[model samples]
Target chain A: MNDTRLIRVVDDDPELRRSLGWMLGGAGLAAELYTSAEQFLERDDLHRSGCVLVDVRMPHMDGLELQRRIRRRGSQLPVVVMSGHADVPTAVHAMEEGALSFLEKPFTKDELLGVLGRALQRADELVQREAAHRADLARIADLTPRELEVMRLVVGGELTKRIAQQLGISERTVDKHRERILAKTGAESWAGLTLLAARLELVSGQPVEALATA
Target chain B: MSTGRDQRQTEPGSVERTPAFPSDAFDHLVSQIDDVFWLYDCQRERVDYVSPAYDRVWGRSAARLLADPLDGLNNAVVAEHREEVRRAFLAGLESGRFEAKYRIRLPDGSERWIHDRGFPIRDPQGRVVHFAGVARDFTERKLTQDRLRESEAFLRATLDALPAHIAIVDPQGVILAVNRSWRQFAECNGLAAPDHAVGLNYLKVCDDAVGPDAAVAREVARGMRGVLDGSQSELMVSYPCDSPDERRWFELRVARFETNRCPLLVAIHLDVTARRRAEEQAVRQQAELAHVARVATIGEMAAGIAHELNQPLSAIANYAEGCLDRVGDDRRPRSDLVDALVHIRNLAQSSGAIIRRLRSAARKSEPRRSSICLNAAVRETVELVRYELETDGVVLEMQLADHLPVVQGDAVQIQQVLLNLLLNAQSAVRHREQPRLTIATRSGKNDVRVSVVDNGPGFGAVAPDRMFESFYSSKPDGLGLGLAISRSIVEAHGGSIWAERVDGCSFFHFTVPYSRPDIASGPPPGVSETGRRLGPAQHKEATA
Candidate 1:
C-alpha cells in the first residue's frame, strides 16, 4: 500500500479512532482520524487518493449519509462502514450507498488491513477511471462535428455503409472519419475504440445510445 | 299533727270520739294525703280506723275496711303476696314491727309495687298497746329503678361484645372502666388485677412497659397524654405486638370525650395484623413483579444491551490489536504502545462494569432500601439504554440537578422505574423523524422529582393518569405492567408517580422522598429489630 494513500477513520468514539490510526500506521498506511462524520466531511482533500472508514452509527451524520454526500460531491473516496454489531439492515444500507466494505467492530488487525487495502484499491481504480474519462472527453472534443457523428455510429455497431447512409455521406468518407476518431481517442483498434466509448458513457452519465444519437 | 298522734294513742273503741285538740284539721289533712293511712288493732286482730286514702288505694270504702280489717290484705294483695302479707301482719302484732314489699292487684287488674312498714305504738310502761303502720304506695319509684337497671345491663353487654380492647380513662389517665375484651386480653397477658387493671394509671403502665414494645409504648403514652390533656383531640398509632404463637399488630386509638360535664378518654386497641400482612403481601408481590419486569425488560433489550457491551469489547480489541501491531515495530515509540494498552485495560474494565450492572438488574434479589444520590442513579440507568437510544437515532438530553438530596429507595427498583420510562419513551419516538427525549431531575420541597419528557404524539385521548393502570396498554404487544409496577415501587419507597401531557409533550414524573437524616441511621419506628430483619425473608417465604 502506498504510504501517501491516506486511510481516514471517522467514528464518534475517540479511543476507537485513535486505535484505528495506530493500527493503520503500523500497517504502513498513513491515517487521519475524525471523531464524527461531520468532522470527516469538513476535509477539503476528499478528492485525494484515499479511502474513508466511517462508523455506521454516528451522532449527526451516519456513515451512509456521509457516503451519499461524498458521492454527491463527485469524490470517489471509497467508504468502509464499521458497525458495532452484526446489524444486517444498516450494513446492507451502507453497502447499497456505495460502501467499499462493511466491517463489524472488534475486527482483527488483518481484517481491518484487508478491508482498507480493498477500499484503497477501489479508490485508485475510481481515480484512474476519472482521469481516463477526462482524457476521453478531451479527445472527443478535438474531433470535427461530422467525424464525431460517424464515431458515435461506428461505436453503435452500425456498418460503415449504414453509417454513411445515416449521415448522408459516402462509405469512404465514413471510414476515414472512424480512423481519425480512433487515432484521437488513442485506441489501437475499432473494438478498443468501442470499449473506450463504453467506459466514457459509464462515467459521463450519458447512455451509449444517447451519445450515438447525438 | 298533735290530734293525729292522740288518735293513734287512743284505744281502738275510743277512736270514733273526736279529739278536742283540732280534730277537723287533722281529718282534713289525712283525707288530702296520697298514702293509705290506716290504724290496725293488733290485740283485737282488727282494723279500728282507716283513713279516706285507704278507699283510693284499696278501691273500697273506708267503712268496709273497718268491718273487715283483713279485707285489703286478702282482696287487694295479689295472690303471690297474700301469704307473705299475712305473715308480716301477724309478725308485726307479735314482734311489734313490720316491713314488707309486695305487689297489689288493683281493681283494673294492673299490679302496683308497694313498700309497707309498721311501727309499734306502746304505752308509757313500754308494753305494746297497738301497731301503728303506714302502708305508703311507692310503685312509680320501683318501676323507674327497674328500667334504669335494664338499660345499664344493655350498655354493659354492648361494650363487652366489641372486638376492640376498650378502656375508658379519666382526664388524669386513670382507667375508670374496661370492657370484657380488655379484661380478656389482660387475663391472657397475665395483667395484675381482677377488674382488668381498672382504676390503674394507664400512663404508668405505658411508661413501665419493657422489652421490644417499650418505645412504641412510650410513644403511645405520649400520644394518650396529648389527647387527655386536650392538646390533641385523638391519637392513633399502629404497633406490632407479635405473640409467641402468631405475629400480630394492633392500632391504638385514644379519643377524648365528655359525659355529664366530665372529660374522659376511650383507649381502644384494635387488631390490625391482617391489614399489615395484606400490605406486606402487596409489597412483596410488587417486588416480585418488578423483578419479573426487570428481567423482561432486559430480555426485550437483549440485542441493544449486547451491542452496548460490544462497543467496549470492540474498543478493547481494537486497542489491543493496535498495541500488538506496534509492539513489533522498533520505530514506534514505547509510549504509544503503553497508551494503547491503557485504553485496552480501561475498555475491559468498562465492559465488565456493564455486565455487572446487567447481572444485578436481571437477578432476583431482595429489594433493599438505602439512601442514594438521584443523579448517580439516573446516570447509571441512562448508561444501560444509551446505546438503544443512539441506535434508534433518538436524541437524549439529561438535565440532572446538582446537589440533589439523597432519596431513600431500593436502587434496583428505582433503576427499573427509570429504565421502564426510558424504554417507553424510546418506543414512542421510534417512528418519529427527529425523536428527542429529555430526562430532568429537580429537588422539590420534600422529595426529588424526576421527569421524562418525550416529543412524540402526546398521550392522545386516553387520560394520562390511566397509564399507570395494570393491563391498560395502548401497544398491541404490550403486557402493560411496566408503569403499574413502577408506580407500586415508587409508592413503596414513599414516593409518587404520575403522568401528564404539556405543550405537545408527554411527561412522566415521579418523586421519591428525601431520606430523612434521622431515619437514615436506623430502621423506621414501630418495627422491631427481628421483624425488620425478617421482613424480606417472610415475604420470600410467603411468595414461595
Candidate 2:
C-alpha cells in the first residue's frame, strides 16, 4: 500500500517536472504528473495517497491558485510549492495556507524529496484519522431515541431526573439510558458520557434536533 | 760591248742605284717607311748607308742628320718629350728590332705623335751592317683614351658628394659600390660602413629592420632577384625607417645592369626623412583638433545629452520596482504584472542604448555604422530636445514620408547631428512670441533627406552660402562649427548637406546615402526632397 501511494507533481516547466519526478521515484515513491491546476482537475487520480508538487510561478495559473483550487476540491493530497527565483512574501503566504512546504528553486533533490516524504506521511495520517473519526461518529448515531435524548441532556448540564421529565420518563429510566450510553461510548460515569457525547458531536448535535422534532 | 756599257752604267748607278754597293739595299728599305735607318760597317765602325726618310722624321735632311749623326733627337722633339724621346729612340736602336713612341711638334704650329721602329740589318756573313726603322703617327688614339679616364673619375666623385644616401649592388646582391653619403648614413643608423657592406646579402638588412614577417621578406627578395636577372625597369620598395623623430623615409631602388642572363644588380637608397616627419605631425594635429571639437560640442550641450538620458533611466527604475511590488500580493493581477515586466524590459533596453550613445560621444570612440531610418532619428532627437524646444515656444511638426528606405551612417552620430540642429533651431526662434519648428524627411533613389524647418525670424539678409563657414554665426552665443561640422559629417557619409531659407523660415537640409551606396543614383532635379519649396510668402516675410 505504501508503494502504491502515487505522488502527484504539477509544474509547467518540463525540465523541473521530469527532475522532480525522477527525484520522487528514486526515493521509492511513485509519481503522477500534472502540468497545471486545470490539468489536475481533469485527472481522475485526485484521490491518490501522495503529496502534490507544484511550482510557484507558471503560465496561466500559479502554484497558490492551484493550491486553493485543490483545497476547494477537498482532495486529501498535500500540496508542495517550489520557485526558481526568490519570492519571500509569496512563499510565506503559501506556507500559511496549509501548504506542506515551500521550496526555493535550485533546491537540492534531497531537500525536495525529504519535504515530499514528510508531506505524504502527513496525508496518510490525515486520511486514516478522517476514516476512523467517521466510523466512530456512525457508531454513536446508532443510539436508541430515548438514550440519544438523555445523552444530549446529560452533556447540556441538565439533571438526569430533569432529562427524564423532559422526555416524560422516570429518573430511573434516564439513569438506565445513561448506563447504556457509557457502555456504548466506553465511558465509566456521567462525566465520561458527557466526554463521549462531545467527542461524537457530529451525531449528538443532529440527534438532539431529531428528538426535539419527535 | 757590254763591258764598256757596264762601265758607264756602273759609274752612273753609283749616284742612283748601284749594284756594287750592298749598303744601298738597306737604304732603299728604310726609305719605304718614314723612318731613319743607318748601317755601320761593323769592321771599321763607319756609316755604310742612311735613308733620306730620316730628314722628314728628324726635321732635318738625311745629309744633315748624318753630319751630326750621333746627336740625340731632343732638339727636334716637343720640349716636354724631347729628352725622354731621345733616350727611348737610342735604346730602341741599340736593341734588335727596337720600337719607340714619342711626340714631336711641326714648325707649322701642329703636334704629331710618332711610333718609331728600328731593325738591325745583317750581311750574308751574319754580321750586323745597319739599323733600319719605321715611324707612324698615333696621337688621336692616345687623346681619346685620356678623355675616357677623366670622365669615369668625375662620375665617382659626384656620386660620393650626393646628400642622399646611395648604394649600388650587383645582380648577386653583392654591394658592388656605394657613395660617401650612403656610408655616412649607415654609420649614423648603427649599420656597418659601406666598405664592410660589400659581399653582404641584401635580405639580411631587411630582416634586421623589419621583424620576421617572412612574407614581406620573401616578396622583396623575389623582386631583388628579378631585377638582377635582366629586368628592364628598376624595382622600388619603401617602408618606415628607424628614427626617433618622424623625419626618416628610406627609398630602395633596385635596377639590373645587364640585358642577358647575368646576375648583377644596382641598388640605390634615398632618404626622405623630412617629408615623413611633416606628414606625421600633420596627422597628429588633425586628430587633436577633432578631439577638441568633440569636447567643445559636448560641453556646450551638456544639459541636452544629460536630459536625453535622465528621463529613460527614471522610467526604468520606477517600472522595475513596480513590477516587484505587484508580483508580491496574494491578489496579484496577472495581466498587470506581465505589463509591468514588459515595460521594465523595454525601458532597460532603451536606457542601455541611450547610455551607449552618450559614452561613445563623450569618449570620442569610433562610431557604429548601420542602416538607419532617417525619419526615426529625426523624430527621436526632437522628442529628446522637446523640453528646450517647448520652453522657447517652438512647436515641432513633422512631414515624414512613409515607407522610406534606410540610410548608411553611424546612428548615434546622426542623432547627435540632428540634436545639434534641433537645438540651434530652437535657440533661433526663442525670442519670438510664437515659434514653430518643422522636421521633414523623404527618400530618393539612393538617398534619404531630412530637414528641420523653423519659422520665427528667417536668415533675413545673411547669404545662404556662408552659413556653413566656421565662426560665421549671427547669434551672440553661436559656435559656427555646428553647421560646418554637420555638413562635414554628412559629406563623410557620401551625401550632400546644406541650408536654405524661405520667407521667415530656415531649413537645415541634408541627405544620407543609401545603405548599399553602390546602388545610389543622383536625385531628380528641381524637386527638393521632403517635397518642400521656398514659397514666396516665406522669403518676403523673413525679409520684412
Candidate 3:
C-alpha cells in the first residue's frame, strides 16, 4: 500500500463504510470515508488522486451516479463498485460506466485488496500523466509569441526560410526563436522539438490539424 | 291523470233538450239506464221533474231527492269535497252549463261516485231560463281507478324499501316514475326529487351530473339509451363518485322493463361507498396483521437476515486477517495493522447499527399504504429470504415485469406474504436435486399478479383450499395462519389468491387490484347481506 494513494469508501451503510475504511487502512492504504456518494463528490479532496469504493445501491445518488459525476467533471478517478445484493445488471452497468471493478458481497480479502490495488494503481498512473502534462503545458506557456509561431511551422515540415518568410521575419531571427523553444522545452534536437511541440499540443493551425489526423 | 269528466266543455243547447220520453217513459228510461234524468224549473225554485233512478245515483227516492231544496245533492256531497262542489255548481248556474263530481253515500250502506251535469236554456227574451241535468253513476270506474292507484303505491313502497335507487324510464329516456329511495338519494345529494325529476329526460340528467363520476354518469346515460332501444338488454358499470365532502361508489345498472304499452328501462343505482370503505379498511387491517407477521417472521429468521448483512461484515473480518500476520512478519507497515484494527472496530459498530435499524423498523411498523412497485417488494422479500434459501441449498430466480403499473397496497404486508411463500418454497425444495424457486410478477387488465413457483414436492394429498384453514399445515412447524392471512390480505384488496400445480411443481399466485381512474372492477365476492365488505372466503374463484 502506497501512502501517497488515498482510497475513498462511499456507502449509505455507516458500518460498511467504516469497516471498509478500516480494512483498507489496515492494509497500509490511507483511506477517506463518505457515508453517501454526494458527500464524497462534494469533498475538496477530490483533486487528490484516489480510488473510490462505492456501494451500487444507495438512497438518492448511487455509486453509478457518483462515477458519472466524477467522470463528467473530468477527474479520471477510478471507481470500484460493490453491492450488498446480487444485482448483476447493475454491476455490469457500473463496469460500463468505467468502474475499475465490480465486486459482490462476501468478496474475499484477496479480492477486495486486489480491486483496490488495481484501481489505486490506475489512479496513480493518471496522476503521474496529469502532472507531466501540466509541466509540459507550463513549458509551452512560457514560449514567446514569435517562438510559438516558429515551432508551429517547424512541426509543419516547413523549411526555416519558409517560416521566416511566412512571419515576415529574417531567417536568422526564426533560427534564434527555434533555439529558445528547444531550450525551454528540453528538446535535444530539431526532431525532438517538433515531437515535443506535438506532444504538448503547441502546434497551431495547419500542423496541429495534420498531426491530429496522422 | 285523466279526469274522465266528459261534460267539461259540452254544448249547453244539446243538454237542454226535453227528456227523451214522457214523464212515465222518462222515469222508466232513467231507472233502466242506471243514471238519473231530472228537470228543474227556475220559476218554482225547486226540483219539478226527477227520475226514479235517483235511487241509483243519490241513494234516495225521487221525492226525497229534493226534500230539502231544489235537490238534496248538496247535502249528499262528501264532507271534504262539499265546498268545491258547491262552488262549481253555483258557477255552473250562471255559465249555462256545469259538470261536477262528488262522492255520496247510497241507501244500501255503499258509497257511490256521481258526475252531475246541468244545462240552462234562455227564454225568447233571453231573461228567464229553464234547467235540466243528469247524474251518472261512476262508482265502478272510480273504484277500479282507486285500486290501480293503491297497487301502484304498494309497488313504489316495495321499491323504496330497497337500499338501491330505482327508476322507471320511458323509451325516450324520460323518467316516468321513481321510487322513494331515488327521491331521498336525490335530495341528499342536493338534486331534484323524483316529483321534480319525473318527465325530465334521464339521459339529460345524467349528462348534466357534476362530480368526478360525471363521466361514469355519461356512460350510464349512453348505456340507458342502449337499453331503451333494445340494442342492449342489460348493463352494469361500477365507478367511483367522490364528492367534495366524502368519497362514494355506486354500481349503475340498466335493464329492460316490459310495460304493457312498450318496453322501458329500469335503472338501479346502489351506493356502494360503505362496501368500498370496508374493503379499504380490511386491507389496512390486513396490513397491520402482516406487519405483525413480518415482525414474527423476522424473529423466525433474524439469524438469516443477519447472515445476509454479515456477508460484508465478514469480508471486513477476512481482509483484516492478514494484518496481524504482516505486522508480525515485518512484511507490512505498522500503519497497516492500525487500519485493520480500525476496520474491525468499525465493522463491529456497523453490525450493531444494522441490527438496530432492522429491529426498530420491524418492531414499530404501522400500516402504511402507498402506490408501490411489485418489483421493489419482490426484491425486499427476496433479501429477507435469500440467506435462508442459500442455507437450504435452494437457488432462487426472479421474473419481474418491466414498467408494470404501480398498485396501491400496504407494501409491508405484501412483502410478508412474499416472504412466507419464499420460505415455503425453500422448505418444499429442501430435499430436491438442484432445488430452484422462481418468483414472478406481471400486470393484468385490472390487477397486478405475483407468482412463486418452485421445483419441489407438491401438495401430496391435501386439497389446496384445505391448506388455508387455520391450524392446517403440512410443515411440522407452520402455523397455517400464513396462507389464511395471505388470502385474506389479497381478497381485502379486491383480488383473488390461488394455488395450483404445474409440471409437478407447486405454484402459489395472487393478484391485487391496481387503482386506475378510468374503469373499476366490481367488489370481490362474499359480501354480507348488509353489503358490507367481507374477508375472502375460499377464494375459490380464481381470476388469472
Candidate 4:
C-alpha cells in the first residue's frame, strides 16, 4: 500500500529533490519530484490519493500557499513542509494552514521516512473517508424527495407525527418513506437509517437544520 | 709773527687776496661765519692762520692751536676716528683735496660730528705751500640719516621671515618687490630673472599662463584685479598646482594697501598641499570605518547566512545518506550509487564556495579595483540575503539586463553597496502587506547603473538628497552610514549615486563607469586580464 502511494517532493534545490527521490525509492516507496510548488500545482491529479512534501521557502508559491490551494480545490492530500532552518513561526504557520507535519532540513533518513510515512498514512485515511462519504452521498441520492425530507426530519429528532405535519402528509406515508430510506441506504434499523442520514449530511456539506428546513 | 702775517694778508693786491674785495674784508667775513677757517703751512710744518670761530667749534683757543697744530687736531679727534682722519688727511694732501667727516671729542667730554673740506695752495713753482679749509658741526643731520637706514633694514627682514611667497605690486599690477620665499620658489620653478620676476606685469603673467593651471590662473588674475580696482577689498583663491612628482595645492590671497597714498597690492601664495592631503586622508579613514561597520552589519545577518549555508550541507547529508543506504543493498545499481556520490561531492563544493564568498566579504582588506559584472555581483549578493527575505516573506525580483557591460570597481565594495541598498529596502517594506523589492541593472552610454527599489512608504518628509548625508537616519538604531558610504565608494570609482521616490517606491540608484576615466586601460596591478588574481600559471602565460 505504501509503495502504491506517491510521495510528491517539491523543492527549488535540484540536488535535494533528486536525493529525496532516491531516498524514498530506496525505502520501497513511490516518489515524484518537482522543482517548484507551481509545477506541482499544475498537475491535474492534485486531488489523487497521495502526500506532498514541499519546502517552506520556494519561489512564488510557498509550501503553506500550496496547502491552501489544495484545500481550496477540495483535495484532502496531506502536506509536509520542510524548512532549511528551524523557524518556529513558519512551522507554526504551516501547521495552522493544515499541514500534516513540519520537517527541518538536515533531518536524518529515519526522520524523513517517519514524517513521510505518517503523512502517507494520513493521506490513506483521508482517501478512505472520502470514498465512504461519496458512497453515502450516492446512496442518499437514490431516495425519493419525500423520503429524503422524512429522513432529514427523522435525523433532526422530530417525531413521526410532527414530521408528517411539517411535510403536510399522513403519518402512515411518513412511515412508508422512512422504510424506503432504510431500504435504499441498506440500513437494517431505524438507528442505522438515522446514522446514514448523518453521514449524508456530513458528506454533502450541509447542516442538518438546513436540510430540515428544505 | 701773527701780527705781521695778518698785516700781509690784509695788504691790497695780496697774492691770496679776493679779486673783488680786500683781504681784510674776507678775514672779517670768515671770523663772523660759524665755520672755522684755518691755514696749514706744509713747508714750515706749522699753523699759519686760524679764525676766531675755532675756539667755539673745536673748544680750543686759537693761540693754543697755533702753538701745536698737530696736537690741536689730534687731541680733538675721537680715538676711533683718529686713524681714518689721519689717513684721509695724508691722502687728501697728496691728492690736492682733503675731505673728512669724523666724530671729535671736545675737552668738555661732549662729542660732535664735523665736516671738513681742504684745498691745496700751490706756489708759483707748483709746489704745495699751505692748506686752507672750513670745518662745520653736522651731528643732528647724521643721526637722522642713520635712523632711516635702520628702519628699512627692519622692514626687509620681516618680509623675508614669512613662509608665504609674497610680492608687492603697484596699481598697474607690476611686481615691485618679492620676498625671499617668493624668490626661492621662483628659482625652484626655473624662473630665469634674478630679481624673482620683479618688474614683471603680474596680471599679464596670470593671463598668459598655460597648461592645466591656465584656467585657475586666469581666475586668480580676475580676483586680484578686483581687489586692486577697489571693487573688492580682498580676494582669495585655492587651486591645484601639481608638480611632476607630487600633487600640490596652493591658496592665493590678495589685499590692497596704501603707503604714502600710493596704492599697492600684497599678493600671498601659501602652500596648502598638506592640508589638502590631510582632508583626503580623513575621508579615506571614514570609508575604512564604514567598511568595518558594514562587516559588523553582516554579523547581524548571521542567521540568514547560516540558513543559506545549511541548504547545501543538508543536501550533502541527504545524498550521502542515500548513497550509504544503496551501497548496503546488493540489488542497487552501481551507476546509481556513483551518481549519488557525485552529487554529494558537488553539494560539498557548493557549500565551500558559499563560505569562501562570506569570508571574502567579511575580511578587512584594502579595496581592489577590477572589472566586475554587475549581474554576477547581484546574483552572489542575493545568495546571502535570500533566506532572510524568504523568512520575512518579502517578494524579491531581479530584472538584471542581459549582456550588461563590466564596470571598474572593487568587487567587495560594490557588493557592500548593493547589500546595503537591499537590506534598507527590505527593512522599509518589512511591515507592509506585500513587501516587494526589485533590483534592476541597466547599461547606459558609458556606464552601468544598478537600482534597488522597494514598495513601501516613500521618503515622505525627507528630501532625496538629504537621505545620503552622513549620520542622517530615519530608523531608531541605524547609524545611517550605509548610503553615505555607498555614495563615497561610487564617487571614488568615478561614478554617481542618488536616491529618489517614484510611484510610492524608494529607489536607490548608482552608476559605475565601464572603465574608470582616471584609470588607464588594462588590468589593475596584481590582477590578470580575466579579472582574476595573477597566479603563477597566469603570470607565466601573461609574460609569454
Candidate 5:
C-alpha cells in the first residue's frame, strides 16, 4: 500500500523533476510530476495521500504561498518545502504551517527522499485519523437513546452515580450504559473518547447541552 | 563812457557820486579794481558813489546803475535769478550787511557769475548813513565746482545699480564705501544698519564667518591681507557659503584701486550658487541612472539566477541517490560510484560559480580598469553563464582570435556586457533544442571588435535602431536596462556598441581600441575611464 501511494514533484526545471522522480522511484516510492505549483493545483493533486515536493523559488505561484493555500483549503496533503541558499529563510518559515520539514539544497538524495517520505507519512496518518474520527462519529450515532445520554454525561466527566442522578437512573444502570457505549465506540478510555471527540470537532472536552443536537 | 558827475545831473542830492575830488592816483586805482565799489547816502535816497569797475563786473555803466540801481541791477542779473538776488539785497539792506551770489548777462552777450557783499556805515547813534558793497565775478570757480559734482553723482549711480557687491576699503582696513548690493546683503543677513559695516574693518568682518564658511572667511582674510600689503596685486577665489537649509556659493574678488594720491582696495562678491548646483545635479543624476540600471537588471534576472543555482543542486542530489542505490544492490561496479562522486563534485563546483557570479552582479562597485585581453574577458564571462547555457540546451560556439592585443578596460564591466548579450540571445530562442550563440573577436589595425551573434528571431518587428533604449524590453519581465548599461560601459571605454539584425540573426557588436601612448599617459583629471579611444566609425555606429 505504501508503494502504491504517490509523491508529487513540482519544480520549474523539467530535468531536475525527472531526476528526482527517478530517484524516488528507486526508493520504492511512486512519483507524479508537475512543472509548477499552478500545474499541481490544476491536476487536483491536493486530494491524494501522496505529499507535494516543491522547490521554494519557482517562477510563478512559488511554493511558500502554495503551502498557505493548501493549508487554508484544509487539505490533508502534506508538503515538503526545499530551497536554494538564497531562499532558505522563507522555506524555513513555511515550516510553521505544518510543512513536513524544510530542506536546504544541494541536499543529498537521501535527505530529499527522507523529507518526501515524512510528508507522505504525515498525509497517511492524517487520512487514517480522519477515517477513525468518522468511524467514531458513526459509532456515537449507533448508541441507544439511553446510552447516548449516559455517554455524553460520562465524557462530560460526571461520575457513574452523578450520571445516573442526572439521567434519573440507578448507579448500576448508569454503569451498564457506560459499558455498552465504550464497547460500541471502541474507546480505550473515557479521556481518550473526549480527546477523539475534540479532534473531530464534535464536542468540547467538557461536554455541554449542545452535544444533544450534535 | 559816462562817469560820476554827469551821472549825478540825473540824480542830484549826490555830493558824492564820488567825493568831488580828482586825485589821479586814487581814481586810477578805483578804475582798475575788479570790484564794483559803490556808496549810497540814506538821506539822499538817490545818488550813489560809483567806481568805474562796474562796467567790467556787471557789463553796465555806473550812470545807468545809479539812475535805477534796483531795476538796473535786476536786468543785469539773469532773469531766472532776479528775485533771489533782490531778496538777498533787501535782507542785507535792513541788517546793514550784504552777501549774495547771482548770475549776470554781460553786455558782450556772455554769462558771468557775481558775488556781492556790502556793509553799512553807522553814525554815533547806531543809525545806518551809507551803504557800501563789492560785487565780484566768480564764474570760473562755479564752473569747476559744477563739473566735479556731476561726475561724482554719475559714479555713485553706476555703482549702486550693479548686481555685484562692491566695497572700497582704505589702506587701514576700514571700509570706506559700499554699493547697494553690499548693503542689501548685509540687511538680509540681519546686519540692519549698513553704515556700521562701512566703518567696520573688513578683516574683522571676515573673522565672524562661522561653521562651514569659517575656512572661506579665513581664506578671504588672507587674500585681502595680501592685497592690503601690496604683496599680491589681485585676489580671486570661489567658496561655498551655505546656510543650514540651502547651499550657496560666492566668488570673492579683490584688487588694488591704485591712485597717485592714495591707493585703496576694491572687494567684490558675486553669487555663483546656481551654476555650482547645476553641475552637482548632473553628477548625481548620472549616478542614479547607473544605480537604477544595476538594480533593475538584477531584479529581472532573479528567477533565472535561482533556476541556475538549483540545477546543480538537484544534480548533486540525483547523483548521491544513484550512488546509494548502487551500494545497496552490491551489483554495480566500483567505477559507478566513482563516476557518481565525480559528477557530484562538478555540480557542487557549478553551484559555487553561480553564487560568485550573482554576488559580483549585485555588488555596487566602481569600475576598476586594468590591462586585459578581450578574449580572456569573453572566456571568463562565458564560464560564469556556461552552466545555464548548457542546461538550456543552447549550442554555444566561440572563435576567439589568437595573439589578441590587450585592451585597456574594466574586466567586470566588460564581462557584464558579454553576460547581458548572451542572456538576451538565450531568451530569444525559447523551446529550441539548438539555440546557437556564437561569440567571436577580431583584431583590426587599431581596435578589436567582439560580436555576440544568435540565430534567433532577429529583432522581430522591432527596429534594430531602437534596441538599446533604456526602457525598451521585448521580454515580459525585462527592465530593458541591460543593453543600455552595456552600451554605456562600452562607450565609457572609448569604444562603441551597436546592434544589427540580418537573416534571422541578432548580433551585438562592441569595439575597444588599443591604448595609445599619448592618451594613456594623459588621462583627463577626474577621468578614471582610461582605455577608451573613440574610433572614426563610432559616431556612425551610434547614429545607426
Candidate 6:
C-alpha cells in the first residue's frame, strides 16, 4: 500500500473510533486516533498531511468547535464532520463552518471510505496550494520597495510619464523600475503581473489595477 | 194675682177712693148667703157641702146633688174613675177632715179632672163632722202633653235599624232583645225564632252545636263569662256552626250594659280549610324527593361497582387455577392434592356466584327476586368488564362483608346498579394522575351496600346530590348514561348507591339484598358461611 496520506479520526466512542481506524486503514491510508478535540490539541505531531474525521457530538467539545479550533491553531486540518443523526440544517451549518464533508452515522463502511478518500485528496490539494503560496510570498519578498511600487503602477496601465509624475521621478527612471519588477515577479506583461498578484493574495479588493487603474 | 200693669193702674186710680177695704171686700164678695145654706147628701156614704166653688165646678144645685143616692153618685162618675173616686172618698172619711182628688162625672156624663177638699161634720162641740171640700177641674193641663209621644217613637225606630246580629241578653246569657237582622240570621241558620230565643239559655244552642261533651261545654261556659265580665272584652272561639262537618271559626264580642244587666255577644265567622291541606301536600313532596335522591346516587355507581367485583373474581380464578395446577403435581400427596382441588373448586363456585351477581347488575334487564350476594355480585360485575380492567391498567380489590344477609330486592338490578358505578369509576381514573378502582361491600343493617373507589382526580367540587342527576358526567365524551341508568336500577331494586372522593380516589358502592340464595346445595360444598372460599385479596401488580 502507498503510505502517501493519512486520515485522522476524532471521536469519543471507542467502538466508532476503532471501526473508522480499521476502515480507513483498509482503504490504503494511515489513520491517527484522537479521543477528543482537546486531546488532539495536545498532540505532539500535527499530522499536516491528513484529513480529520470528527464526530459531531461528544461529551465536552463538539465537532464544529473542534474544526474552528484546528483552523485557529494553523493546522490546515481538513475536517469531515460525521453526525449520528444528520439533519439538513445542522449539516448545512457544519459545511458553512469549513467542513470538508458531513456524513451521517450508521453509514456504510464504503460510504466512510469514499468520503474520507475524497477528503484526503482535497487536503492534498490545499497543502500544495499552501506550499506554492509560501514560495510565491518569498519570491515577492525579494523585490525592492521602488520596484514593488513600479510594479503596482505598471499593472495599473499608467504610461511611463504618468508613472514618473505619480512617483515624482523621471519617466526613464519609472521605466527602469517597472522592467526590474516584471523580471523579479516573472510577469511577461502587465495582465500577467496582476494575475500573479491575485494568485498570491497580494491585494484585498477586487481587480483594482487589472480593470484599468489609470 | 195681678200683673205689673194692673198694679200701676190700681195705684193711679186710687185717688179719694173708698178702697172698698179690699181684703174684707174680697172675702165678702165670694161668700153668698143664699148659695146653699144647707148641707148636701147623696147616695150611700156620699155628702156634699154647699161651696160657691163647687157650684161653679159642678154647675148644679147643691140640694139636688145631695138628694141623689151615694150609689148613683158613684155611678155618675166616669166609668174609668168611679172606683178610684170612691176609694179616695172612703180614705178621707176614715181620717178627720178628709181631702181627695178625683175625676168626676158631670150631669151630662162628661169627664172632668177635679180637686176636692172635704172634712167630716161633727155633732155639737167638736164631735165627728161630715166631710166638706171644694173641688176644681184641671182638664186643660192634661191636654198639653205631646213631646213625650214623639220621643217614644224615635227610640223604637233606632233599635230596629241595626245590621249586625245584635242581641241584648241577661247575665244568664238569655236573649232579651234581638234586632230584625239578628232574627233573619237565626232563621237562616236553623235557630229558634228571635222571640223564642229571648229567655232561652244561650248554652242550649252551644250544647246542640258542640255536642254533649262536658269539657267543651265547660269551655264554652267560661268563654261566655269572660265576655260578660269585661275581663275578656270579646269572646272568640271556633266551632262547627254553618260548616257543621268541619270546624268553623267564630269571633263573639260581648259587651255588658248596666241598663239591661246583660252582656251583648256578637259572633263573626270565617273558614280556613284549603290552606291547611296545601301545607300538608308540600311536606309530602319534600320527603319523596329526598328518598329519590338517595336511591339515584347508588344506582349511578353500578358500573364501577361491577369492575370492583370483577377484580376479586379474577383474583379468585387465578388463585384457584394455580391451586388446581399444583394439585396435579406428584410432589403433593393425593389426599392433600384432592383437598386443594376441592378448595379451588369452592373458590370457583364462589366466584361463579359473584359473576352471577355481576351479570345481574350489568344486564339489569330483569329483576331477580332473592337475597343478593353483594360481594359476589360486585366481583361478577367486575368480571363482565374484564377487558376494560386489563386495558385501563387498573387493578381492583374487594373487602366484602363476610356474613352479609341477603338484602331484599332484585339481584340483577342491584348488579347493574353496581356495574354502572364501576364503569364510571374506571372512566374517572382512566387518565388519573394516579389510577385505581377499589370496590368494597359491607353488610348494612337492612342492606348490603357496596362501593367502588378510585385514586384519581375526584368529582372536582360538585355537590354529591347533583352528581347523580341524569346527564351529569365528568368525562369529555361521556353521555352521562351510566349514573342515570344505575340510579334507575337501584331505585327499581329498592337499594341505594352513591359516589364520594376519599384520599384522592373515587369510590362507588351499592348494595343488593345480601342474603345468599340456596346453593341448590348450599354454596357448592366447600364454601363456608364467611365466604372463606373466596380466598385472600390478590392483585396482579403492574407499573400502570
Candidate 6: tens digits of C-alpha lDDT, residues B1-544: 1234322323221322436557456436546432222232322344443444445555565555566635334544566766776677667666643444566676776766665555444444544434444455665554433345556566546655654455566676655666665556555444544352555556444433322233333455566677677776555432222233453222234455565533465432223234333533443343244334334533544444443444334334333444444554676567744544454466567557655644433342222355556767777667665546554667777777787665655555555566567777777777754466778877776666777787877777797766777878787766565576666556544456676667756666665543333221122111112210000000000000
Summed over model 6, clashes come to: 71
- RMSD versus native structure for model 4: 12.7
Task: Estimate, for each residue in B432-460, the C-alpha lDDT of model 4 and write its tens digit.
Answer: 99999999999999899999999989888
What's the TM-score of chain A alone for every prediction? 0.78, 0.84, 0.88, 0.88, 0.74, 0.85
Q: Is the docking of candidate 2 incorrect, acceptable, medium or high quality?
A: incorrect
lDDT for each residue of candidate 6 in A1-214, tens digit (9 for 90 to 100): 5665777788875545754554454344688888988998888256568788887766458889988888787777678998755367879999999898998765665676688778878878887988887766665666776776676666656688888898899988887887788787676787877877677544443433332321
Q: So what's the TM-score on candidate 3?
A: 0.51
Against the native complex, each candidate's DockQ, computed on alpha carbons, is: 0.40, 0.01, 0.07, 0.38, 0.16, 0.01
- Model 6 chain B, poorest ten-residue lDDT window? B534-543
Best candidate (score: DockQ): 1
